[model samples]
Target: MRLLASSLLLLCLSAYSEGTVISKEPGESIHLTCSSEECPTYSNEYHYLYLYYTIDEEAEVVFSNIKSERFSPRGKYESRTKLDIHNRTITLSNLTASDTGIYKCVYKKSSTEKITCSVYAVFITEKTPCSTVSPAVEPSPVLMYIIFVCIISVLAMWILMLLILPKVQQRFIKRRAMHAHQSSADNVYEIMRREEGAQVAAPIGLV
Candidate 1:
């Protein structure tokens, strides 16, 4: 009988050390387990279990054993929360972005012993596309200045061409007139030299 009692006590101690609360995502159910092995004259009598949640600096009691299905919330959380003591689980439906927080489970037994466990619940928050809706992505002032400079350069080149074309045409006309005058003077000098040579040949023949 003593050996049996010793074995049962060891088993109960091992089970009491195994209570745990698992971390879960928001909008999903989480199970908290409090178990003990068979022991003589020791019935598992839990007085109450409290579930608490803190979200964004607001604290609230999510579940309690006194009211099985009557866990209340401040606002916008009346119908979205549920607690089941039979399964030691808490279910939150249609979780929103504001549901991300820490959850703690406290269990009180009739023997005045308390067991506590904690888990983190994370809710996904949808963020807007920052790259598409920003006004800072407009065209830079440097790019606009570069475009203006290019336009000014093109206009300056066009004006320079207009100013140089008339001077080039006048230079070409003067060169052509000077060439014609020189050719006419050379032709008159050649005719006079030819007449002198003819007179000299006629005199030699007469001698």
Candidate 2:
């Protein structure tokens, strides 16, 4: 009986000393068991169970058993943690990278008797979100100014052509009309000179 009890104690102590590593992504949940099996049952009045997490060598209490069946959570875990005494587990939800650490449960059976349960080394990996929206690029003021200048120049050239084309056409038509009148006058004068020459030459021959 004595040997059997000592072996059982050794087994329990070995189980407590063993460590477990748990890995998860951010915003996920994890269940941390205090012991491999159900935690040693104790009277409600004498039971004092607390869960703690350590990060960057700093430890803080996560779950605290107030009295018999009452419990309280501290700090950032006020709403994200759920403690199940019946299952001897603590479920931490909505995990983040800052929550990566070592977690352990401590049970104070009496004033001088305390038991620390299994330790969990938790690792929370943060995934960066991919962006599909393209960044807004501002229009270059110099480019815009150049485009505006080009448009204005084209419009100015078109308006200038519209104003000058009718004047050019009128000048061309007037020059054509003057040249036609000069040609007609020259043709009539040449015919009159030829008729006078013929009359003078013929009358002299007849006389």
Off by over 4 Å in 2: 1-18, 37-39, 43-46, 128-207
In candidate 1, position 194 carries an lDDT of 96
- What does candidate 1's lDDT look like per residue over 1-207, in tens digits? 323332333333223234332333345544433222221111445446655664324465554543343444435555765665555556666664345444556665644676666443332333336578644333235333333444555567677788777788889999999999989999999998999999889989999
| Tens-digit lDDT string for candidate 2 (1-207) | 323332332333233335776767889999988755435555534377778885324565564553556777778888898878776678999998567656888777676877777777675644534676345444335333433444555668678789788889999999999999999999999999999999999989998
Off by over 4 Å in 1: 1-43, 55-58, 66-76, 109-113, 127-207
Query: Ten-residue segment with the worst summed lDDT in candidate 2?
Result: 5-14
Determine which window of 10 residues in candidate 1 has minimal summed lDDT.
33-42
RMSD of 1: 36.0
lDDT of 1: 0.50
Best by TM-score: 2
Mind sharing the TM-score for model 2? 0.48
